[model samples]
Target: MFYKYKCGNEIIRVFVWNDDFHNEVSVEDTKTQKSYDRTIREDENGKFFTWNRNTIYLNDWIKISMKELKEKIENGERITSDDLCQAIMTDGVENVRFIAPLNIRCGFGFFLNGNEFKDTLCKVEERWNREIKQNYKIVLIPVESDDSVANSADYYTEDFVSLIKCGNIKIAETQKLIHQEQSNEDYFEGVNDYFDGTMGV
Candidate 1:
């Protein structure tokens, strides 16, 4: 399922509000459709004619479960950008998190040290709450590298968790590796850091 999120360069997902209405009732009571005669009326001035005169507002995020969202994507009925904006405004989140997977081939990726990135991210988080809605800019913090390694290694997950706890990052959703038809590119313009001074693998 495809969930609509506020995305940026390093920011994976954030919240956005949506203002839409849901049609839950039908007018003209018939055997085919259920009747809403017993439903409580808020604005009593209006009465049902063809459909239930009651207007239902959907202000919060339209969270279709993973199963549901995927079905809609398959069916080509998924939500749009407008829908996502409405959802965030309606949900009203004080703070949000963004996370990404990391693997090191040469130099560290996204943040060289914990403190530098942490401090930058803290500024971003604050600015997000004060200024931007869906246009926040994410700085790509370079990761620190260890020269002792010879081959590439998966990034440490503990550091990721620590960043989250310290409010420098957030975990959104786990990514699934899906193979699809696509062109392949093998562009190696630079040397891998892992092979800098180490012997043959």
Candidate 2:
């Protein structure tokens, strides 16, 4: 089963059912053309959208595709390419996770929303009420010069601070999460490694 959407001129197809486990395609707003903004526009047309492959309607105008892939992106899953446009648009830089450059040659950056990302402690909705509250984001570098995603990094090894460590307060990777419930301390422990930590400063 697929969840389809029509946003402005874009056509989004989501591989929903994991029964056959085809592709979760967790990324959103995928257009035939790569050029897309997360904000849904209501005034455009010329695209087609189908839901469950059962229902589809048409608006009018130009039916054009935006992306033609000549090659597949390596490790793009870590970049969260699906969420990049929206995250950048909303100033929610803290919501992105960095793994690598789109290409060492291409300055293009994408966001990877891994299966492990959403349920991670950093993005958890329960934070605002916690004592050491913070928004966590993952960076691949050694340290964040400041709090901005572009300059931030939280590199770590399993149960060890390999290089850079930044969070609400300082937390070591040695702490293990034993509590079935995620307490305040357990929250930080969840991000113990760079996989890792989301309890950002």
Candidate 3:
């Protein structure tokens, strides 16, 4: 069976399959392409057993119902990214897994915009830094495809040492640093080359 639920501007698809021995479920966000899959097995006594269940994390909170979120949207309420973050924090949820954006490929782990909510941006930076400190080789990439977004590249720096010690630098600052040192016509290409050179790639 398959079901579709709308949450604000996003669509979530839920798929389920069952047999005499086991049941499988998959939930996917059409907007972000983030997904979770789970399976449950039936025992001899006809009781179901599962070691783990899939969950949807809105920020750090585990949101149990897409139906409720859809209802709120249908009722003409506006749900912003900040609202999602607030819900997660207030719900006292923990151990949430981070889902990378669909546009971001492997080797890069985070994408931040200059227009993001300040608190949400700070929280994400903190989480990424913590992962870095734990020896995760996560790279922060700042994207600027146009003049408006490119203007924000003024926030990131190329000082990797400072970035390691302080995780607050923006991707724009790094771009600015690269522009100053290199004469590449493509800003992103310059940034990519910088990292590649640093990594000896």
Query: Which structure among the candidates has the greatest lDDT?
Result: 3
Q: Please provide, for model 3 over 16-122, each residue's C-alpha lDDT reduced to its tens digit, 9 standing for 90 to 100.
A: 44234435556675556876665544444443322123232222222433233335545666543233333323322231112222232222324545344221111
lDDT of 2: 0.28
How do the residues 55-154 of candidate 2 rate in per-residue lDDT, one tens digit apiece? 2333221121111110112223232222322222232333323222211211242343232121112221122222111212333332223221232223
What order do you get sorting by TM-score, best first?
Answer: 1, 3, 2
**How many clashes in each structure?**
19, 17, 8
Best by TM-score: 1
lDDT of 1 at 43: 43
TM-score, predicted candidate 1 vs. hidden true structure: 0.22
Q: For candidate 1, lDDT tens digit of each residue in 1-201?
A: 112322122211212221124223222233454424223233444421122332332222134332332344346574443332233233332222234322233355433432222211111222322322332223222233333222122222334334444444442321111111111111121234334643344
Q: Report lDDT (Cα) of residue 183, candidate 2.
A: 79
All-Cα superposition RMSD per candidate = 18.7, 18.9, 18.9
Instruction: Assess each prediction's global lDDT (C-alpha) against the native.
Output: 0.29, 0.28, 0.35
